[model samples]
Target: MHLLHDRGRPLPAPVPVPRDAAGARRLAAVYAPPPDRVHVRAMMNTTVDGAVSGADGISGSLRNPDDSFAFGVLRALADVILVGARTVREEDYRRPQGRADLLEPSRRPGGGPRPALAILTRTGLLPRTIEPDWPTYLLVPRASREAVVAAGIVPADQVLAADAPADAVARLAEMGHRAIQAEGGPGALGQLVAAGVVDELCFSLTHRTVGGSSSRVLDGPAHEQDWHLASLIVGERATLTRYTRA
Candidate 1:
């Protein structure tokens, strides 16, 4: 990754990252969260023109190797992944597995497990194609718990009821998940931003521009927040930027 802008420290010069153990550790350090307490960061990919998806209505078309590498590193460092129900369905979300080499060493000595999945859904609706073995927390409205359970989307033990976005995030922090990352579906991200719970945003900007009616990275009612550029890493086909909430 090329160092374009960095306010923290002088980063190493850009180099082609090999798909190996050492490369994974190096990438994780590029955006590692502070270990003191829970930090909520949003990770999203967008085109140069600010479209979140292409004509196919999916964000995969805009991805490149560097972005995929960064994605895995972020997931490996996170304690739990927060996502919206729509993103889970559209992205075919499943239990993260087979990356023990990347995720295991990041865990605390007695930590419960490596990165659990927590989905936010007000209607308690989930995709039918979700894997049964993939454990997840269905954060639903307190009143909708019964309806969600009846839908058989997930096991009863994994259901978590919350009144608002802040509540769910707070609960996760209480459960010792301090390094949190939200892989969003815009609406959920907007809620977190509106609630003033987001601490940072990691955006991968692809070089291509797909002009259409596709949503921006964060979508919701008009709510403005200030962010400061923390770092910018230029990749071969995309640029990875980290913005901390001001």
Candidate 2:
């Protein structure tokens, strides 16, 4: 991988992204959140034509080795990962296996080796594949709170009462979570964008295009926000760009 830009400035020479253990540490450092405050970073992979998925109809098909590496790096660096319920189901989301050495021991109130998974859903029903155990939290409205609790999917404390996407984010912050990473489905991403909670967008573009009905990275109504490219890199037959809200 080669970096094309850093801090939004054009780099005269490309920088290589290493593949060894030291390389992994470097990659995590590239994604570390600001130490002073919580940062909400949203990441997604898409086709060249803006479709969020490849011809195979999944985001995985649009990724290459380098993109996969960056994905893991982000998960390893985050304090908690916020993802849509639909995305969790579609992506067959599993408990994050964070690199023990890369995890921040100071970000979250409770120090855990891996980033916890926070699932956003208004419905009380959860995917059968999902196990509501420790390190897993559900974001749902108060209306669905009883049903979710009654279903015995997770502990009552793990079921957060929230009516909107912004509410969910606020609740996460209250729990002492910083460096939040939202691996999204467009709908969920859209809501967060609309809520004005998204601080940065880590977008990866594939080398190919798929002419389909796949949604864009953000699927909400008209809501414009200024963004500036924080960094850009090329590798794995894809372009990885980080855009920060301005």
Candidate 3:
């Protein structure tokens, strides 16, 4: 991994990223949220031609080592991981942390709780990948909470009532979260984009292109918004770009 540009200025040369702990800390600083307020960061991976996944219809097929590095760093900096239920099903999201050993040291003081995973769903139906041991939070409507829990699927304590993506974000913020990471399956990304609460987009592009039937990064009603490039880094296997809402 190497940083090519920052704050709209091109660096004279690329800086090689080391495979040590120092490198992880440096990368974490770049993705860290602004301190005084709640921030929503949307992270996504796409092919050069704008497909979010490969022929098999999962984003995993599009991931490479360099891309995974950036993704892990972003996850490490977040207070919560937000995604739609469909994304959980498709991605087989099983754990709160990935590559924990490669993350920056002392990210949380004295072995703090792992970043919470929040899934946005109307039906409250979860994939089997979500285990009983792994704590989870579900954002759904208030009226359905009782039945959803009565099904013995998830605990009542784990469910948070949210009618929409914006509401889910607000609830998360109220829970003292200042950094929210939105990892999407297109529909969820679109909802957050439409909600107008996204502060930064950590969009990544792999070196290869997948001309499959995969959808673009955002999927929903057409809407337009302006953004300014904040940082651009070119890695050995992917190009990572961060855009701030204008």
Give the alpha carbon lDDT tens digit for every residue of 1-246 in model 1: 655556655556645445567767766666778877778999999988999888889887888987887787778778788999898878878875424677665542215456778899888777876665655788888999888888877788677788898888977776678877898888888888888999999998988888879998888767888999898877778888899988
Clashing pairs in 1: none
Clashing pairs in 3: none
Off by over 4 Å in 1: 7-20, 97-100, 107-110
User: What's each prediction's TM-score?
Assistant: 0.90, 0.93, 0.92
For model 1 the local lDDT of residue 166 reads: 87
**What would the TM-score be for candidate 1 when compared with the true structure?**
0.90
lDDT of 1: 0.79
Local error of candidate 3 at 10, Å? 2.7
Q: What are the per-residue Cα lDDT tens digits for candidate 2 across 26-144?
A: 66666667866878999998878899887777787887877777777777778798989888887787787556556655333235567888999888556787776647889998898
Tell me the number of clashing residue pairs for each predicted model.
Answer: 0, 0, 0
What is candidate 2's TM-score against the reference? 0.93
**lDDT string, candidate 3, 1-246, tens digits:** 888777767879986665456776777766667766788999999988999988888899999987888888777777778998998988898675744763445353212356778888888788877875665778889888777777666677778888877788888877766778899979989988988989898888999877857898999768899998888888878999999999
True-structure lDDT of candidate 2: 0.81
